[model samples]
Target: MLELDASAHPGGIALWGAVLAVYDTSSMPPEIGIHVHARSTREGDKQVDDTFDTVVVKLSPDEQATITGDTAINFYLSRFLNRDIKLLRCPHCDEAHLDAGYFAVRPHRRHMCQACGRQFNDSEKSISNPVSLLKRVHYDVPPVRAPRNLDVKQTSYPGGMQIWASNPALVWTSARAEEAGLHIHLYDSQGNIVVDDTFDHVEVDGIELNEVHVQYFMAQQALPHLSEKIVSLTCPRCDRPHFDTGDSAFFPHVEHTCEHCNEKFVSKGRRKLVVSNPFEAVRKSLRANWQSHRI
Candidate 1:
């Protein structure tokens, strides 16, 4: 319930107060605007190394007034949690910048940001919070290392395995191979056999070139759904509303030219034009109307 402007605190006293609240298992005010949870303790900073503290939490971008304080907050939280922590989906993009990879949830390793394209471990660029993140439950996946014995039998693919893959069109079954009793040959639509030549090999097709990692596979399955929401765009000179487009329209309808700035603008998804910048200035009566919408 402590409310104070960040500037009013010395040596980030306010930040320490938030950390203390979480460490004490106390509830934060609604105005605090972040979820918190406890995590395993980690090494670093004698203070954080000795006590329970905030580990992970989400923060809206605007709440992050400066990058310096954010970094300090993250350092303290990571030491408190003893693990790499990160902001979840970007509030603006609402999409993860980090692509699902083989070691996504591994303990030591950290996930990358699908929005800002920054590694979670890269403290220099990450946004931090005073609260922690809640752990979400997921199907327990086993490791996918090669069997110690090469002569051992191969693993089989689980049901709904076909739904995995970044590019579905890139995946298809080689029925001809199966017909010849050669086993199910999965090809990368380009016919570059991805996990082919192994009839009995279970779960042959993996995200990686070698054996597939389960975390990566599960992530690949959920990625598309996350990508389905919110679009992004770049405004060269004259800004246009790019993220406001609907989900049904194509790129052609999203392109627009700015008269005043004489710059070309483009949108990535189906959202209609609404001035892409969240804080665009009014220009209705300006010389040439710096912004315009494409049909």
Candidate 2:
């Protein structure tokens, strides 16, 4: 449950953190299981090959899970691709489990697995099946690390969030988050609301979301307090918290449009991120090979 050392970069902590890597190292191909070396058999002195026996061993627990674990499969968020945490496999040894050390200081296709010291293109085979890549989408709340500064005592709790190795990707497509949608408010001592807001659907990088994405949005924006709301913008004037839904949450602030209002701005000098409130505009549907997981 421990986090990376205090010296770990903020970006490193986000990409790696308590991330547990479960490698799909099973070499058994689908339907065509692992094959043993072919042996020669003779028949009637004609050197004719005898029939081969097919073995269908009972699947291991892990293997059985693979068949029904579609909702539990591992996938990376492209929102995190600037660091390219998306693909950490090895070409020399087709290893799926690797670390951020394998990546360059910045975004690049080059990588060398620390396990095998072998080179690979982060772009090459980054995705095994491109066509089947686009699968079900879900929201995730990444593990949160605590701040070490003295100011932290006054601002937040001591313990931080965690995504244990046992199930780093358990929250990949959380049913709880999906069902909860997004709720922003505070109650008084008497259970009266201070400020109330609800979003049945929120949008991130053009991805329509609900309660499903609140945790993820908070993590991306680094909102220290859970009470901190995801948005401050509302509509009618087209003036809302300006965000680039077209822009990435991982590497956001490229587009000058509001995520909720979709209002485009021409200001050369503007804040990195404006106030709360998503741009509420209709955009053409955009689907990508996206998936969700816990860590």
Candidate 3:
């Protein structure tokens, strides 16, 4: 059999080679090591990873090494099966069994095979090869987001469903609650918090809410209200927004202390109005129509 280090081979389908030698597993080999496997699969590249579904295997190198060209000789065979095999054919079934040795029973052959259920042969023959993986060693494996969603707030809790970790907990919580119902939170692209009543209890006792699109024709129904106010006082030093709504919306020189930066600054009494409650007022409103099709 041919053996090479080159990556492109017809035998590339094999992640594990066939067993070469079967030794008494009374001990283990020392050179064997493991690799923890994980992959990031989606960010434009993989935007996400699955840590929970990871496997425990001999760790493949994080960076794959480039393999090219071929080695000169067959350093190994398939299953790394080289010239060092020690097996004999069972006369009755033509099956291969580990040859014990010539000296064990010099005058006669005495062997029993479990595989083919062949009776022991009382004839004389030669016995030869032996296999051992006794020094088998395995090293220990040393172990080692998101939000484009609009600021959908839990305006009413106990009213909305909190996802339970298990089926029993979900059933129990559904039964003994002060408030139990279906709840939906809508977040639009370009940052808008949707506030609408339809996002509330559809079944009043439902555990599932149909995910509604934040865009399209039916989006008008799921769209949040666009009439809400946002008040803020930001520090020029720290860029921390403050919520101090004591004076009117038109105070000229509002004294402010930034909790983040611990610096003080003065600015106008600020009360900016953001279109909330399923806000869809966009400069690209026509684009949402002309660029995309009706749903």
* Model 3 agreement with the true structure over 132-172: per-residue lDDT tens digits: 11111112311111112222322222122121100001001
- Provide the overall lDDT of each model, using Cα atoms, as 2-decimal numbers: 0.26, 0.28, 0.25
Q: TM per model?
A: 0.16, 0.32, 0.17
Which is the leading candidate under TM-score?
2
- Measured by lDDT, the strongest candidate is 2
CA shift at 230, candidate 2, in angstroms?
Answer: 10
Q: How would you order the candidates by lDDT, starting with the best?
A: 2, 1, 3
| Span of 10 residues, lowest total lDDT, candidate 3 | 164-173
lDDT of 1: 0.26
lDDT of 2 by residue, 1-295 (tens): 1111212221111111122211111122221111111112211121211111222111222221111111112122222233223435576887553332212113455666656877777544332211122232234544332211111110121111111112122112222222222432333334443433333443333354332233344333322221222343344347554443322333323234555666665423344333332312211111121111112
RMSD in Å for model 2: 20.5
Model 2: weakest 10-residue lDDT segment is 149-158
Please list the residue runs of candidate 1 whose C-alpha ends up more than 4 Å from where it truly belongs after superposition: 1-12, 17-77, 84-110, 116-295
